[model samples]
Target: MRIATWNVNSVRQRLDHLLGYLGAVAPDVLCLQELKCTDDSFPRQEIEAAGYHCNVHGQKGFNGVAILSRRPVEATAGLPGEPEDTQARFIEARVPDGGGEILVASIYLPNGNPVGTDKYPYKLRFMDRLAAHARQRLAEGATLVLAGDYNVIPDRRDAADPEAWVHDALFLPETRERYRTLVSLGLTDALRATTDHAGVYSFWDYQAGAWQRNKGIRIDHLLLSSRAADRLVDVTIDKDMRAAEKPSDHVPVRIDLR
Candidate 1:
């Protein structure tokens, strides 16, 4: 099955591009981030009419997520982090594909910009929570696949210039360490698991001529559990989406699992 993730930036603004990509890719499961819409305002009918079931966890105008599936989606759950945290950053569902089940989740992890700040602390704490929850999911022995915009540059090679982001939250040592702790729990970075190329990226900033210069970052990712990783066939980044009219800063990343 083909599974994918994308941070659309805004659901309403990129609806046409999103529809086009979905039609072109035809992934079995699609996890979305940064929907930036409310539950009532989500274009469920439009997505459903395209022949995929939409399970959405949306908020006002910031972080929101959704899972679209060609197969039956069941056992939906929201907020693997905490109820007190109360951010529409996570949504998980059980997708029935042929003989087995796939636990699919869409996540919009916190983008803490400044390094020494309250938001940075929150980001670390959030990662801690996510790590704990992911470990629990790993213990369940299910084929778990978590996909979305993590807002983290996992390594120096993930960014265009490592020294440029020395003090940025996403590239801070603590942040990278926390992210590493999560991945160490038997979760596979599906893209890196497939290839070892540098300069391959998923996100580029609209400001400061980032896209024009190819100053991009690999913040968006599809992480697979050990069982799921064993089935990973191929992974790709749809860089062409970034060149579309009224494009999102982030594009799509897909993984083929068999």
Candidate 2:
């Protein structure tokens, strides 16, 4: 099975680029984040015509997520145990691939910029809820994959200039610790598990020649549960998409499994 994740930034704005990718790469399942549009505004017709079934969880102007699968799928929207949390940042589903179904989530983790504000704490709380949910799913013996623009830089190895992000919310000690806690639950950071290579980035800021200089960060990820990771075949970052016409600041990260 091939699963891919990309923060399309704005699905409407990047629809063309996204269609191009669907044709070019053709992942069996594509998890999308940052839709920035309401469910009614999602390009369902275009997507369906391209031959994928989509499950979208979106709000009017910001923070939305979706899961697109080539095969049939059953999906449930939003993160569990956070009824108070209304942000459109999570969507989960079960997609079959001949052998069995795998649980997949398209997540748009909080950016939590401007530290020391309410946003930072929300970010941590969100991670905690997700961690709890992940732990439950793991206990159920599901082949699970949590993929999206995590918005956390994990480690220095994930950032081009680690010092530059040291004080930023995404790389702050507390935030990184929360991410570590998630992985400690036995989720495999698929890309990291597949290779030890450095300088492999999945996102580049549109400002300051970040893409031109190849100064990017590997924030977008496809973390798999052991039940799924055992089938891992390869992991790839579609860096070429960053160079495409009116591209997203981030690129796609894909993982293949048996």
Candidate 3:
């Protein structure tokens, strides 16, 4: 199975670029974040016509997520479970086939920019909720895969310039610790499992000529449970996608498994 994750920034703005990549790479399952559209605005017909079934959880303007799969996707629950925090940031789905049932989650974690602000606290709180949810999923004995723009950098090896990000929200010690706590529950960083090298990035700043200079951050990721990671074959970041016309600030990170 091939699963891919990308933060499209705004699905409507990058729909063309997305369609082109979908045709070329053709992952069995594609998880998207930052759709930046209301549920009604999601282009369902266009996506369905491309031979994939989509399960979308979206709100207006910012922070949306969706899962697209070649097989039937049974809509599951959204994360955190707080009725007041319904910003469409999480969605789970099950793809049932003869082999078994595959559980996939698409997430858009809080960006948490400008540390020492409300957003930063929300990011930490959100991480706690995510950790709890992951623990529940692990207990269910499901072949689980969680993919998305995590918005938190796990370590110095995952960042372009570690010094520059010292005080940034993504690299803050507390935030990183929360991420570590969650993954400690038997989830593997599928990309890091294949290589130990640094300077591999998935996102670049549009305002800073970061892409041209190759100054980027590896924020997006595919973290899988042991049940799924055992079958991992390959992991790749489509850096080329970042150069596409009207491309997203982020690009796709793909994992191929048995």
Q: Which candidate is the best by TM-score?
A: 2
Off by over 4 Å in 1: none
Worst 10 residues of 2 by lDDT: 92-101
Off by over 4 Å in 3: none
Ranking by TM-score: 2, 3, 1
By TM-score, how accurate is candidate 3? Answer: 0.97
Q: Check candidate 3 and list the clashing pairs.
A: none
lDDT of 3 by residue, 108-198 (tens): 8998888878989888888899889989989999888989999988889887888889999999999899999989999999989999999
**Model 1, 1-258: lDDT tens per residue?**
999999999998999998898899999988999999998999989898888888888989889999988866884646555667877888898988678788988988898876666888888888898888899988988789989999889988898887888888888888889989989999999989988888989999999989989999999988899889999989989999999998999999999988
User: Which regions of candidate 2 deviate over 4 angstroms?
Assistant: none
Tens-digit lDDT string for candidate 2 (4-80) = 99999999999999998999999999999999999999999999999999899998888999999998799999888
Give one clash count per candidate, in the order shown. 0, 0, 0
Cα lDDT for residue 141, model 3? 90
lDDT of 2: 0.92
lDDT of each: 0.89, 0.92, 0.89
- List the candidates' TM-scores in order: 0.97, 0.98, 0.97
Clash pairs for candidate 2? none
